[model samples]
Target: MTPPNTGRRSEASRRAVLTAALDLLQEVEYAKISIEGLASRAGVGKQTIYRWWPSKGAVIFDAFLMLSEGAEGGPVQLPDTGDLAADLTEVLRATVTELNEPRYEQPMRALATEIAHDPELAAIYAERLDGPLREAKRQRLRRAQRAGQLAEDLDLDVAVDLIWGPLFQRWLHRSGPLTTEYADRLVATALDGLRPRR
Candidate 1:
């Protein structure tokens, strides 16, 4: 059936599709979800879904983005403080929390596992989920450097890698506990390393 053109019902149908997609994504692996399945679950026609979203991946990713959005429908973002260490600590601590939350953790793992083999899915994940957060951190670091909190000549790409690498490694390998304390420690170590030698 074609989705109703009325504004209220259209919004409702969109929410249903989004909610159903997220529900299925959390329950099943990424590769197992189909647009037909989502439409059935959402109680909308496949044509309606196609009209709104380009593909199953787009719908699933949109659902994931919605599920992970911060307050006011924004992505999880880094905060800028004059103190670089404090800002990093705040951001990484929140990251630890999200990584520890099962609702997000499981879905993230499912996406990561599949995207490794599918470049299209990987690109979507990179652009939608990871890109904004990385850019925010880069902007924050640049601001800090200008404020004299970091070495003027620091390489931002390496600095970002240093800041986020270990955390992602641990998250990927499950080699150690991901805790706020660890996040704080990571920030302190990076800050110490970034300081110019006296």
Candidate 2:
């Protein structure tokens, strides 16, 4: 029960809608982004957006997902270099780049601001953003622990937070420059403290 071109059209529409939603997020605040605006800018009907996504937050979250997953590669994943420090550094370095991208900055800020004000919106963002990102990090850390790259007694949850918390603070707070060097230093410091002594 599908036309030959239906899938193509749907794919195109999804891209268009995501594009328009992000564009509008930059133009307006997160609270202002609406399905109606996305539909208009995407050149699709409101029903089209509704058919694909249950809510506007879901649509914007999808856009964020697309950006994080990236276009060149299928999706971003934690690195595995057998050196846990190196892997974490590379992943964090890439995250710094993603955070600094001009296209992502405005929209992410809008989302953060919106989430700060709306608990429901915050839940949606948590599910869409943290759900994937945190879980991936947790898995990687567990693997590193099993490989003897980390302390056997270390709490994985605490380890994940220790790795991500500072960078996220710097990002959300605009504390200072987010550079590869900074990420590397963080990884080194954490590794020195976390890796079990021989």
Candidate 3:
């Protein structure tokens, strides 16, 4: 399914559909959600949804993205108060909170599952969500490098993964708690290698 042309889309209807999707997701498991349910909840025709979104996963993903963007209306950004360790700690702690939030956990897991199996949807996820975020993380790392806080020759891409990969793995596998303390440890341990040599 082709991505919707924003030029022709109605903002009001789009918001309704996204809101309905989130509401419906809260009411039932992801596997149980249907386009019909979304249409009815949103008070729009099924064709309206089909016109804009390629699949159920796409709609749900957009809903989560919208929620993340928030009422302030901006792309989410990682904290960059010039303290690399503190900024990473703050971001990771928030990640733990979001991953553990009951409202978000199921829908996020559902999206993750869809991205894993559907190459097209996965591409969209990476393009719309993951890419910007990784860039922001790298931007922060670059700042640290320039300030002589981080290894000058460090690979930002791998550094981003080193900090985030474990937390995600733990959450995805249910291998351990995603507590603030765990987030702190992840940042500290990753920074041990990232910090500039003595």
Best by TM-score: 3
- For model 3, where is the 10-residue window of minimal lDDT? 1-10
lDDT of 2 by residue, 1-198 (tens): 788699888999999998898788778866677778889999999999999887676676678767756543543368787888888888889889988988989767766666777688788777766767787888889898898877899998898888889998899899999999999999888878766857
RMSD of each: 3.7, 3.7, 4.5
Cα shift from native, residue 97, model 1 (Å): 0.4
* Residue-wise C-alpha lDDT for candidate 1, range 20-48, written one tens digit per residue: 97788778866788888999999999999
Candidate 3: clashing pairs of residues? none
lDDT computed for candidate 3: 0.86
Candidate 2 ranges beyond 4 A from true positions: 5-7, 69-77, 110-129, 194-198
Estimate every model's Cα lDDT from 0 to 1.
0.80, 0.82, 0.86
Listed per model in order, the count of residue pairs whose N, CA or C atoms clash below 3 Å is 0, 0, 0
In candidate 3, what are the lDDT values of residues 49-99, reduced to their tens digit? Answer: 999998998998988888877633565567888888899999899889989
TM-score of each: 0.78, 0.76, 0.84
Evaluated with lDDT, which candidate comes out highest? 3
lDDT-better candidate, 2 vs 3:
3
**By TM-score: ranked, best first:** 3, 1, 2
Q: lDDT at 75 for candidate 2?
A: 39
* Model 1 steric clash pairs: none
